[model samples]
Target chain A: MKRYTVTIGDITHVVDLQPLNDAEHYRVWVDGQVYDVALSEAPDHEPQVHPHPSTEAIPSASPAAARDRPADTATEPADLRAPMPGVILEVNVEPGAEVQRGDQVLVLEAMKMKNAIRSPRSGIVAEVLVRPGQSVNYDEPLLRYRQG
Target chain B: MNLLDTLLAGLLSLSWGQVVMMGIGGLLIYLAIAKEYEPVLLLPIGAGAILANLPLSPLVGDDGLLTILYNAGVGNEMFPLLIFVGIGAMTDFGPLLEQPHMLLMGAAGQFGIFGTLFLALLLGFDINEAASIGIIGAIDGPTSIYVSNQLAPHLLGPIAVVAYSYMSLVPIIQPPIMRALVSRRQRLIRMPYSQRPVSRRTRILFPIIVTAVVGLLVPMAIPLIGMLMLGNLMKEAGVVERLVGASSNEIANAVTLFLGLAIGATMRAEAFLRPQTLLILLLGIFAFGLDTAAGLVFARLLRWVVRGPLNPLIGAAGISAFPMAARVVQRVAQEEDFENFLLMHAMGANTAGQIASVVAGGVVLALFAAR
Candidate 1:
């Protein structure tokens, strides 16, 4: 479940969306009221709304989201963690560096293959805990963040 | 005079074929040592090939060591079955268990095996040999060995080398096809790892149930799946650390040497340098690319309908290369949008491919065993 503060005009609503079996359907709570929603690709003129009111998907209350925002830009904590065990090949982000979701923050070498760990959200890096050539374990936190 | 003549015979009896094969052996060793490609198996295989091709080498006759290992393990398919246990103990099905629907993509990955078989038949290979060559697309070395040795023992040398080499080349082979087939938007799609934890009881029962079910469905696969699940059962059972350690580490290491050497011994110039070997090599890469393509197309079809969290990149990993295929998929996705993490989802598809490939191998045997 993800919580989003959605604003339409002057009225702001706190909405929580929970996915059902598929990405299209969701059980959502809007300002404490619950509704079941199913999302589908809409024709050009139609709005992208589903089980919840078409008001929210992006986690932040700010208007940084776009009209073309993807449905999966689900809010997550800004801090990034190593997805698997590996050695840090490089660090691309430092504390106070502004980053977008999907920006490569570091490269990790695992099983002789290199993987880049990307920022989970558009946030300011608070701290980087690892350095190049340092071996790390699975789920070990690699970075801390302040939300953008 | 006879004793002096016999001593000089070894120096005089060199053939162009033996010389060429020895060079090939050197290449294999260079690949293993310098390129770091599946060294544990390839190094022994390279050495065995060199030993087998030595002028009047004693290690390759009826009473010879290499021949003995070949007869004992590879000829009868003992080594592959043993290796399957090791592979099972090493694989963790947690991600696959977390998401079960990925099995469909796994099934889709086998289309290449059949596709290659048809192409090989058209190119004049007998049906059984074609099937053995096709199994290289399965991308699991031991299964490739088991199926090929069972179906076309003569083709085992080329098939083994091709399978291992292509398995190593997966990252390169898959990315272009994946990029071509899946759109950028689809590649950038995110699939967070599922949080649902599989229960300990479910983990333990998983191997047992899979063995019984897969065994009954394709009884010929019983040998492959049974041993695989047995090793999996040991790992999940939690009471068999010693057993799991031996199966996954020491025993696997030992059998890999015997298997590699035995397989290499079969690569006598007379066997390994056929025109058909070239065809098998071509068909192996073709089949691998086809499997990746088929998987991507299948997943795209799924996304068209269900429409959520279905990253087509995960489809590329729907092959038996295990975590390697999955890792490649993850890397590709991250290349497009660093924030999108598809590793867990790709792993689900990869592990599914592993099981499906084994089952497909059994199906092949069941169909052609009578021939």
Candidate 2:
């Protein structure tokens, strides 16, 4: 049993969870609140969780295969980030746009504040990953940049 | 009396005090528009002051629109709570969760709130009134309202104005204090950007857990924390997109308009012209300065233990201006090292400051109530 102190919305709950045979499945008791948790790896660190249906079976990964997978897959380089989690108000720099450090590359509107995301270093823009109005995470690469 | 004679008489009877207050009000308006200092509050406040100081404006009268708004929102404390809902919907606590220890910085930054509270008491302001005045140091509007409404409702207008005014001045007041507290080498420290993927379960559970813990600790904070968490839970739940959108946008906008206008209208010359108001304004600035100093000092202490680059300037982000304080930290960090990017770290501390300010506000109320 792994004891996890989970704090949600200002209330801290000491949770004890019995790990299942499958890496993704666990029986969690959070301060007496029971939750059956299933973990899934999302693309690009997007926090998307679909509650598992009661009838769905937990998929098990063998110990040998589990050992081969590397940890820390979610870390992204600093140059590629959303600046703030918000709707992309505009994307000014396109693929192959030669940009210098501090060049305004995109406008993000979060909590009614218009923030300009600038290029981290002088580079040739490799790809623009998001479009206008696309909601992005804090670490998701907004664009790729190659050395100019 | 003839119409011309009555009009001239009314113009001539305008009090010198009212004229001076009007001019002071106009200066505030000018600062808001021209200098762009806290435009959201100052613009409306300046307008309200001007209108009220006019020879015979109906706006301050019993039947006036301003009076009606004041009664509907500010006097009753509904608008600030509603605004908290919007603030809740808009806030992203992921940064704070990623760096749980940053909460210490937030706590340290709130020294201004209590520090100023003590100072106000020293100046002979009564316990309850001093508590209300000291909350302006929190640099948070809703918390200021929540505390002042309970302790000293009469001082609400000055406290709110000072709270917001000093919040905007964070960029100006904080940087120098930060510099003074930390050396050039400290500011140049580059924090590595590390992104830890937070689970949706954790996100959804955060507001609930925080509300429960804080509410249990300070029952008076139940309303404020409950409403804040309610909004956060709605946003994190992902199923309540429509409710989140409405709360964050429409409800927030409506509340801000009402809250801003009503808060402004409370600055009647008679109420706001006193020396106490001036002292409140001065103490408000001092409180913010002290808060920034405390955060920087705490960050320097943490640097001794924590590995990796911990930019001390990011500690200044502990003030509760949300992203603005974070951006200012980012800007200052960029000035020090062209390659250094501290935005994410600054944001983490800034988000922690948001929660810390609420907790600090609650703690203050709890302390005063206990007394």
Candidate 3:
């Protein structure tokens, strides 16, 4: 068994790893907590697991829950998310507004400094979810663009 | 009758010069309390100045508070080095490591130190004195005090004042120079921040490598650079959070109070009232302006050589003033084009300048120490 310390954010966890019978699996002890984890061949190649046909009959209305309902909702990738936590100082785009890639979508004020959040791709603004003076957290979707 | 006579004698002993010196102290206190100009140092220094010059005050006499503090640290170069530990603990070198080319701007920023040294030499100051005075261009308080105390102990008060005053005035002094050198078009150039994640291993190694390299090259700089890098290493190791907090906050604060008071006590009228003091003040400003201009000019030259969106304004951030220099660069760029965010790039250059300034200080010591 080999010990390694990993820090996630402000917390540090000391992990002890011991290889099992197979080369691909290991028994890990993290801060006295035990977990059995398997090493994957291709970590970046995410296997798409399709849902049951009966579950796909009615699509979930919430777009944010992509992990739970990945069939139809995950395909809509035009949502521009806030890159950092800040107050929305200004919303430069409105609903139905045409925008190009690299266009300034909104202004965010964090730590008394202003940052310009730009659009990811060219599309029509289908919805502006954030308003001026509204605070937003990191990775929170600020606006959605209509599919071409 | 004897008590009344003693009171009269004490009142009579107070000179016009002492009164003026006390007023200067009051002004410094007012600036610290009211204007908030470097309150940590200025407050103690101001109070020390008052105590040192008072009629028969025991604060600065033999074995007094101010005298003992001066002997304990400022005189022997302990305070500044201790303060360096705090500075290192507080500084994040991630930006500088991400972009190593910013090191050139840091080196270029030291032009003012040499330029001012030459000017001071011409103005009748000795080579040692001139070099100490020139280090005010470093835009670093502890480094300035450390170098000047060693080279020219008499000129410590004026040099420290000039270094800090200009450091606080970074926003005001640097903007005009930046605008003058880089046109609105160049300032508007958006250098997109490429997030090159620095590994934890690299962060841990950085301070160690820097210390060995700098120490081997310029042995005189070992004290300042070594302490600084030691603080940085502890911060990156992640095992010493309590030590880091204490070094950056508590120790730094305590040292600042003592260092400031000791430096202030040295400013008695006999030593401080010379015509050379005024000259040093002017030369100090001249050196700072030269450093800024040199950094801007060097950045413009780099833009010509490098094929990319380079904002020459960020070059001005290559002084040792830390985050302030970077912030000024960002503000200047934003004024011309709000969409342009040069803060990350400026920070890279700013941190690079911090290391470069220490190196320059070491180089200065080497040059003088050889003689």
TM-score of each: 0.81, 0.75, 0.76
Q: B117 in model 3: Cα distance from truth in Å?
A: 0.3
Give candidate 2's TM-score. Answer: 0.75
How well does model 1 score by local distance difference test? Answer: 0.82
lDDT of 2 by residue, B299-331 (tens): 888877876557788788887878778887876
lDDT of each: 0.82, 0.75, 0.80
Better of 1 and 2 by TM-score: 1
How displaced is residue B43 in candidate 3, in Å? 1.9
Best by DockQ: 1
User: What's model 2's overall lDDT?
Assistant: 0.75
Give one digit per residue, the lDDT tens place, for model 1 in B1-371: 88987988877798888888889888889999999888888888889989999889999988999999999999899999999999899888887898889888899988899999999999999999989988887888998999999899889999998998888889889999999998765675655443466899999999999999999899999999999999999999999999999999999999999999988888889998889989998999999999999999999988867634578888888899988899999878767555555777788899899999999999989988779
Query: Tens digit of lDDT per residue, candidate 3, span A1-148?
Result: 6543332322233445688998667787766789876655544544343221111222333324322332222222458776545699999989999987568899888534677777745679999998999988655779998876
DockQ of each two-chain model:
0.12, 0.03, 0.02
lDDT of 2 at B55: 72
Error of 2 at B141 (Å): 1.7
For each candidate, report what fraction of the true interface contacts it reproduces: 0.17, 0.02, 0.00
Per-residue error for B255 in candidate 1, Å, reads: 0.4
TM-score leader = 1
- DockQ class, candidate 3: incorrect
